[model samples]
Target chain A: AQSVSQHNHHVILSEAASLELGCNYSYGGTVNLFWYVQYPGQHLQLLLKYFSGDPLVKGIKGFEAEFIKSKFSFNLRKPSVQWSDTAEYFCAVRGSASYDKVIFGPGTSLSVIP
Target chain B: EAGVAQSPRYKIIEKRQSVAFWCNPISGHATLYWYQQILGQGPKLLIQFQNNGVVDDSQLPKDRFSAERLKGVDSTLKIQPAKLEDSAVYLCASSPAGVRAGELFFGEGSRLTVL
Candidate 1:
């Protein structure tokens, strides 16, 4: 079974501060990685995903993640964050070969001070 | 296009009572999923459906929980004799088939409060 681990449970940051959330998965074979975000009183939405091609992938809202196969990590990064970025982020992973189930991490709550 | 639709945005029930949540996936989507999201935790897959057949229900507590997608369009999840631990947000998601099959589009979720 595949499992995802997020290093930080909660993160506090000021406006314009750079942010990075650590995410690692325990899967040996080829896998698909995704970052999902849920704002206050909203449904979960996809932030970005990495299936193949370049290691780095960009998604909506200037968010990006890099799939480091060697490290088994796909940490999310943003050079600057705004107050609207305050939300809960979840990291998910699934094997690419078959219809494998996607496993999610505990999630990281980000609170950006305005 | 409209996103996934879920009904009974909030539900409250006493212990040992029953509750059911409905979900309508996006049009043309070939897969539907039901996930349970406890407070402060990420969503956990309770069941997955590819069309009308079940793809996975390994994490579902089958003894108390039951779900079905009869027409391969809308789905219903029912829990009989609910427990306190069953209190969570039931999220419905769907994805297209083929290359984009894994990317999920989620619903607003149905929140359940077991007292």
Candidate 2:
């Protein structure tokens, strides 16, 4: 089974502050990476995804993630975050050989100060 | 388009009791998945189905948990003699089969509590 690790379990940042969430995967193979977010009382929504093409993938809400194969890392970052960005972020992966079996990291909780 | 829909937004049951959760996937999605999300933890894939056939159930506790997606549309997951450890939110998701980069659309999830 492939395991994913998020360096920060909880993060606190003020409005307009730069944000970065670290994600690392254990599997070394053809994999698809993704970041999902869940706001309070809402279902999980897609933040961004990295398939093949470029390592840097931009997603909704001015967020992006860079896929670093050499480091086995796909870190999510944003230049400035808003209070709306306060939510639970999850990093997920699916190996091509696994028949699309998706695996998710524990998740990182982000709280944005007003 | 309508997203995945789940019933019984919340449920509470005693240990050794039986409970069931239902899911209705997107109108035309070919793949459906069941996941368990414990508090402060990520969602764990419990089972996956391709249409009406079972694709994966390796992580499911066969002795107590059973799921079936009959008629290739709606699915139901049942846990008999549920344990305390089974207390968690159950999420139902769906995706287009063979779509390598497609994201799984998730439901609001059914929260469960067992005493």
Candidate 3:
């Protein structure tokens, strides 16, 4: 059974603070990883994705995630957070051979304070 | 280009009732998907359709859930005799054809509250 786990349920940070959201998956085969964000009253939007090539991927709004194969993790990070960064983030994975279906992690909620 | 479109942004139904959600994918998209997102959780894939064919329905609860994509453009997801646990947001998404890593465009979603 494949599953994605988001360790942090909720995180609160002041403006300009660094942000890191942990994500781990239990799959040995090749996988496609994605990070999605949902702001208040908005639909889910793709932040970034990791297919092949590089392990470090940058996305919109100054977000980035590094895929660590050894650790089975693709943790999202931001150097400096802003109040507008408050939203819910999700990590997802799909098999490399075919994008038949995607499995998503529970989700992590971030609240940025000014 | 317009993103995926879903109707009835919100719905409130009693348990054991029936409900349906409609989705219109972006023009020329060949892949469509339905997902259910419970409060405070990530969206869960319920079904996937490639054109007019069903590619995957492994996660869908067939006993109470059914979906169809007639003509391969628009889709409908229905829940019969809905249960309290069915209270969630139903999202519809679509992607372009022949791309291995195509990004999915999601709709606003239809929120269902089963009282």
Candidate 4:
């Protein structure tokens, strides 16, 4: 079975701090990676996705993720985070070349103190 | 375009009861998805539908859970004899067909509380 792992369960940072959330997948075949965010009381929304392009992908709200094939990792990063950026983040992966199911990691809750 | 729409934003039922939730996908979207999100956890795919046919349902609990997209436009997910563990938010999402990597548009979600 394919699975995604997120190293951070919960993170607390002051405003304007840099953010990095680690994500790794357990799949040997080609994969599509994604980052989704859910603000408080809001539905899940896509942050960014890695289909088959440059390893570094930029997303909304100043978010970006680097897909490192060598490490089987797609880590989400931001140079500066604001209090509004506080939310629950999820990392998901689906198999490429096939319409396989998308698997989600446990999730990481980020809290940015103003 | 409007996002996915779900009905009965919140539901509370006792264990062993049956409950159903409805979802309406975005216009012209052929792919629909249903997910279960437990508190403090990420959403888990429960089923996926392409048009009026099921594309995937491996994670759905067949014994107690079932879902269908009758006209390939609207969908319903039902849980019979709901268990306490079934308390979670049910999310509905949809994407354009034939796209290899399209972002999903999600609804507000139906929150279920199985007491």
Candidate 5:
């Protein structure tokens, strides 16, 4: 079965610190990658997605992700993060067209202190 | 545009009790999805529907869980004789565009606790 994995389960950082959450997946074929964020008391929101083209995809809230097919990884990165950026990050993937189910990683909880 | 709506922000039931959750997807959304997110974990896809038809439910425990989207709109998910492990947040999502790709709007989710 296909699965997604996030290396860090919990992270704490000061405001303005750089952020990088590692995500990796196990799939044999092409896939659509995504990064989602869930702020407290809020629903999950899209951070960015990679369907095709450039490996580096920019998303809302100064977030970006790079899809490295060779590593089966799509890591989320932010040069500087604000306290408001503290939230749970999830990496997900669905098989390119042929697969329907979108698999999500366990998640990484980031706590940004001001 | 309105996002997906879910009812009963939270619920607590005994292990053997049955529970149900309701969701109303965004208007005109052809694809609807049900996901379960346990504490400290990412959302897990339970079922998917495209225009009232089942698209993918491989992860759903049909023996104790069932879901339906009537008329390709509103949806309901039910769990019979729920177990303690069934405790989790149930999320409803919609893809206004086809299920092909891109963004998915999600509801605030209904948290369930089975004692």
Candidate 6:
């Protein structure tokens, strides 16, 4: 079975602090990676996705993620984060063999203090 | 374009009761999805539909849970003899067909409280 793992369960940071959330998946085949964000009381939306790209994918809101295929990792990064960025982040993966199912990680909650 | 719409935004039912939720996906979207999101956890895929056909339903609890997408436009999910562990937010999402791993537009979700 394919699975996703997010290292950070919860994080607290001050405004303008840099952010990097680690995500790793357990799959040995072609895969599609994605990061989704859910704001308080809001539905989940896509942040970014990587299929066959330059490894570095830029997304909306100054967010970017690097897909390191060898490491089986796709880490989301932002040079600086604002209080508005506080939300829950989920890493998802869809294996080529089973494109119908997208497995999601446990999620990481980020709290930005203003 | 209108985003996915879900009905019965909130539902509370005792264990062993039955409940149903409805969803209307975006116009022209052939792929629809249902996910269960427990508090403090990420959304878990329960089923996926392509057009009027079932594309995937591996995680759905067949014994007590059932879903159908009629006419490939609207969908309904029902839970019979609901269990306490079934308390969660049921999310409906949709995407265009043939877009592999495409972005999913989600609805506000139907929150269920199985007491």
After the best TM-score superposition of candidate 1, give how far the Cα of residue A94 lies from its true spot, in angstroms.
1.0
- lDDT tens per residue, model 6, B36-104: 999988889999998888988999999999999999999999999999999999999987756454568
**Who wins the DockQ comparison?**
1
The candidates' DockQ values read 0.75, 0.64, 0.66, 0.65, 0.67, 0.62
Worst 10 residues of 6 chain A by lDDT: A94-103
Candidate 3's TM-score reads: 0.97
| TM-score of each candidate structure, all chains considered together | 0.98, 0.97, 0.97, 0.97, 0.96, 0.96
Cα lDDT of model 4 by residue, A1-114, tens digit: 889999999999999999999999999798889999999989999999998879999999899999999999999999999999999999999887445677889999999999
lDDT per residue as tens, model 2, A24-114: 9988688999999999999998998988889999999999999999999999999999999999999999887535688999999999998
lDDT of 5 by residue, A1-114 (tens): 789999999999999999999999998888889999999888899889998899999999999999998899999999999999989999998887633668899999999999
On lDDT, the leading prediction is 1
List per-prediction Cα lDDT, in the order shown.
0.94, 0.93, 0.92, 0.92, 0.91, 0.92
lDDT of 1: 0.94
Q: What is the TM-score of chain A alone in each candidate?
A: 0.98, 0.96, 0.97, 0.98, 0.97, 0.96
Decoy 1 TM-score against native = 0.98
DockQ of 5: 0.67
Clashing pairs in 1: none
**Model 3: runs farther than 4 Å from truth?**
B100-102
- Stretches > 4 Å off in candidate 5: B98-102
* Recovery fraction of native interface contacts for candidate 6: 0.58
Q: Model 1 chain A, poorest ten-residue lDDT window?
A: A94-103
Identify the runs in model 1 with alpha carbons over 4 angstroms from their true place: none
Sort by DockQ, best first: what order?
1, 5, 3, 4, 2, 6
- Note the B-chain TM-score for every model: 0.99, 0.96, 0.97, 0.96, 0.96, 0.96
lDDT of 5 at B113: 98
